[model samples]
Target: MIKKAPVGEIPFAIAGDSRIYVTAFVNGSDSLRFLVDTGASSIVLNTNSPKLKGLIHNGELADNLGTSGENSVEYSNDNSVKVGTIQYDKAGCAHIPYPPEYWDGVFGLNGLAAFNIEINYDDFKIYCYPKETLTVEDSYVSLPFTYKYDVPFVHLHIKLNGTLHNLLLEVDTGSDRIIDLNTPFVNKNNLLETKKPFAISRIASSDGGSGELKNVFFDEVIVGPYIMPKVAGAFSTLIFGMQSKENIDGMIGNNFLKRFNMLIDFNADKLYLQPNNFYYTPFYDFLVR
Candidate 1:
């Protein structure tokens, strides 16, 4: 089902051992080996990284725990961060958790959000263009959702026997599978009607925290022009705070994204969903490998 969505690949490079790193730029200056994390709300760095010592302002001790479950008091402040050809001046920054073994820091939406992002998994390269200036020559559609830090999320509003329910979902690029729900939507829906619950396991985040997984078999889940039927997700009532809103329902992750071609315009705050043939052909062959 995911294969039917638009897909592409790029020849992206990853650095570091434990933490895969990528390159970045700030004000056109070279900055290297930044962690690429779609799950993080903002860019962050280790206090010991050469990049953070002098560039950060108003640095303060802050407590942070990510999907990895590593707890640490890292610095939270503002700074200019660069990765490859992209840079963000006065971007938000936080501390890298734990002893900081592998990565210098993470390159998150706080910086990437400034530009239109085009990730070509087929080519393994990421392109950053001015979001405010780009125009779509191609015809596309946009799904409705509330965005926090430029990430698109949907609220699962389900109905059963005249009763209605709702849950917020984050569309995640970093997640490997689909249907990560916090509050097992089916469990509630089942209570209204007699049906066997789909068996699911506990799903873990990149940070290593686990949540109750529930299979959501929806008549139709719509985003843009694409619709997913009987999609599976995790019930994540406990991890709602991981997203901008608590009581969040679930997250749409790679399992869904890999299905379609995607265009994200950060500066303009627009997202365009196009057919796979138009955007994914160049790198589609590679993705199959």
Candidate 2:
């Protein structure tokens, strides 16, 4: 018997800094992290990495425009990627012969659209809402914020070291990981140690310049009373676009959002997040204003 997926919940996972995590198998191997990127038209390597062999190939190169509007060349292969129990037949991706410098392969929207997914950036969690029942509370609510606009991100709060450190965080659905910081924010907080370095790769700026990749451990990241332990983040030194003028420490991306059920009510000046488990408090209310 063919069984249908449960309702209200989407099948998805996230990994890396703030990227969506997809459990995909390469060449009948175990599932691994496939970063979800909506902005990318196709997938490519950071520079030069062995993972290139994992991508299925049919001998075709494609031209791509990067985030900074630079032309990127790639090759697509016909490979089947398995996520969860569902297998995508004829799955194809752009193959980079070598990762640029410090880059990793991403599973962009073309790969993710195969499944129905909804993510709440504010809660640092994404709910696999049951397809059978759709809740009405998913609508937007205005939170008490100094800003006059009723934007979705204005209400999320940032917590540092497991404590509310009075830092501002922007919830970006477009981002793949939980938290990604700009150079200024990292420097202002003195968060990085020059002697220590970690290797990570992603899509670089249009100019083909290196994107800063650093490992970070926050004692805790708290938003609306939700706490994530041993969280990792990125510190980007490259100024790809206009510097983040929002003065935010970083962005809250899907890496964290895929963990729980969230309710955002902007009109009430509060955001609610309910944990999947009972040991923790179900409701987390935040006062943005």
Candidate 3:
């Protein structure tokens, strides 16, 4: 008989704009708030945090790039890192620049990959289960996904004008926008020729790099059995060096994902979606004027 591992649930605080934050303990002493980001590949701590004193510095610099810009991070290892009742010994961590005022660090895929995680947007809680014991309900829509550089990518179909085209989209909870499409995909599909009006906006990366983007609204986007209509998105011609290796078309961000309670099974390569209370909530176009 297979042994059953204990499941754990951790409550998270939601930002006004839908960012999720959870409290974690480092070395069993300092309690810090960390943003749960599926888009990030590793656990990232703020260099300025007092908890850094408890970690053993590895002396190697790790480089990370985001829409904000590139940052050189310091590598470290902790004896014990705990989230609720689950704990990881000798956990690897990277000390990067301090995040925004609301967050001190990021709980990333490096630590999260060990278990199946469910982000319950409706209840502001995270359910975690060992890979062997987790199971999905019949009500959930299960979609197959692939990971590139530790980031999850899912297939989605968008109707442009009258034609439906399948595209690969990254599941990026760290991104606040609804969707961001690369210029190559837009040009190839002649998306600019659509009748929908677009607005020019400035897009910024985590490292403060800025670029211009054309924001537009799509009438229909299909993900499994769900149809998301009147979705807002942006098209960017600027390509980051890190993205060159990724064979993806766009990214699906929090503005669209917050509508559902999501279960990401990295081991099984599946993404499970269950629409929540926010399913019908109006899309907020904070990035566009």
> lDDT score, residue 276, model 1?
51
Order the candidate numbers by lDDT, best to worst: 3, 1, 2
Instruction: TM-score winner between 2 and 3, please give it.
Output: 3
TM-score each candidate: 0.62, 0.44, 0.86
* Local accuracy of candidate 1 as per-residue lDDT tens digits, 14-35: 2211122476543233454566
Task: Write candidate 3's Cα lDDT for 1-289 as tens digits.
Answer: 1124338777887676667788888765578888888888888776666665545355477777665357676777654678866688888887775634646678888878878888888778887777753466777888898986568888889876667878788888876667877667877766776644557767665454666667787768886788987677776666663232236787887878888889887778888888889888777644344
Lowest-sum lDDT 10-residue window in model 1: 1-10
Q: What is the lDDT of candidate 3?
A: 0.73
Question: Clash totals for all models, in order?
Answer: 41, 48, 7
Q: After superposition, how far is residue 286 of candidate 1 from its true place, in Å?
A: 21
Model 2 regions more than 4 Å off:
1-20, 27-31, 43-55, 97-104, 119-207, 211-289
Candidate 2 lDDT over residue span 1-289, tens digit each = 0023333332454334434555456556544545545444444333344444444455465655432233446555666665555555666676543333333456554544443344444333333322232234433332332321112244444444444465554444345545666567767766676324344546444234445556555555555555555455666564544123335445455545445444432234333454443223211121122
Candidate 3 ranges beyond 4 A from true positions: 1-6, 49-58, 68-72, 99-102, 192-201, 206-208, 241-246, 285-289
